[model samples]
Target: MAASVDSPTPAASLNQEESTTGSTPFLRNGTVMSRSVKISSIPDPSLGTDERVGESDRAKRMKEDSLLLLRGFDSIAQNLSQLSSNLGSALQGARYLAEPPTLREIFHSRIENSESRQEEVEKEKIEGGKNTGLKRKFDPDERSEDQGNDFLNENEQCLEDKKLKKAKNLAVSMATKAAALARELKSIKSDLCFMQERCALLEEENRRIRDGFGEGTRLEEDDLMRLQMEALLAEKSRLGNENANLKRENQCLHQLVEYHQITTQDLSASYEQVITCLDFSSPTSSMMEEADNEDD
Candidate 1:
């Protein structure tokens, strides 16, 4: 009974050492010595391995989403670059379509002269007798029977022929100008239609980009860009119409120049004919006529 009571104390001590060290305490030779030592590490008991793995997976997902967002931003930037380039090109094209500064100055001068000539044309049309202005002022006392009536009639016929030829040339020039203006108008219309289609395509692409991104602010900005594009298209159309009208006005001015040219030639030719007739008259006859007038 004494040995049995003492045996329980050593066994209890062995069990205590095993519980504290997390290993069995082995007996060696005559004394018991620890074969392995356990070093305790600090760890939060609440954060289990499973919970840590879940957090890691969530972090990975967040990283992936961030990367995706970055890519989306990059794509948006590329789209913006393309849009900016397109707008620049469109503006450049518009600039090219506009008249040059030098040409504009020329057009201004032409227009001023055209307006004045138009007034003259209106007067000519209203008078219905352009010959009245062309006819040279002459005195009946200067008339002579010696100047054959046949010669005077012949001069009149020649003048009529020259007038007819000038009229034909002016008509031909007007027809040619009208044809050119028509062609220019057609080209402008075609260009406008092409630009309209291009704008429509851009708008559709913008809508798709907006829908894909699903960003409210970006969508609104795109909408504003679309509105600006529409306004630009409207302005371009207005300018095209204005240009066409200006072309027509220019054509009218060109016709006026032709008319003036023909009229000038006709006046010069008549003046030459009149001077020739005066030169052919006798000087003695003119002196006698002067003496007779003085006696009266």
Candidate 2:
């Protein structure tokens, strides 16, 4: 800004000097215009202390306004950075809430399988019980062999005894197979009962975990909502404060405008004096006045 303010002096000086349309003031050793004479040295036809003071004050106020606007931009940037960080943190917590139902389903399925096995065993036991009942009904016929004296022929008696022995062996084999099957069925029932209990416990635990997760989710949402509300309120406050600051700046500008209006009257008087001298002296003075009027 200082460089720009200072750079204009050389151009103004060239305009005042002898008319040389192509006189480009070369800066150091090459291309750019570097050093320039100060504006005070260029002879304006009319000047005063009060106009000088007004110009200086306007420049100072403008510089201060630029500084304030820069600071406001920095504050806005910092707020945006903080908001981004908070959103990132919220995303991480959401990923951890998805695991208990899978374990519960697996446990329940195992329990169902165990119960089905038990049912199959009970069905086999019922079939074996019916066979055992038929064997019991024929048990009395085997006892008739005790009256062996009626058969006096040894061959007939020996053949009858052999047939009885074969029947007895078959009954014993069938009983052994039935007893083994019953024992297996008993074991399977116990295993099913145990699995049912375990699965029930696991399901209860799953419910608790789900409840806990729900509570956590509600808490997080509540916390997030509260945080968001607070952020909104804070933003409102910041905006309000900024608006107040802007209002103050606007007030300052209004006051500055009023001050400039007062100064403009004095400058106008000085300007009228300068115009009188310019009209008698230079042809381009009309153009300069037009340009200056446009700038104003």
Q: Candidates' lDDT values, in order?
A: 0.68, 0.59
Model 1: CA > 4 A from native: 1-147, 209-214, 217-296
Pairs with backbone N, CA or C atoms under 3 Å apart (clashes), candidate 1: none
The TM-score values for the models, in the order shown, are: 0.30, 0.20
Residue-level error in angstroms, candidate 2, position 215: 4.4
The digit string of per-residue lDDT tens for model 2 on 11-111 reads 78777553443454442323222213444457665566778988999999999999999999999999999998888877766654553444335545655
Candidate 2 residue-pair clash tally: 0
Candidate 2 achieves a global lDDT of 0.59
- Residue range 65-132, candidate 1, lDDT tens digits: 99999999999999999999999999999998794654334545655675586578658644743443
Give the best candidate by lDDT.
1
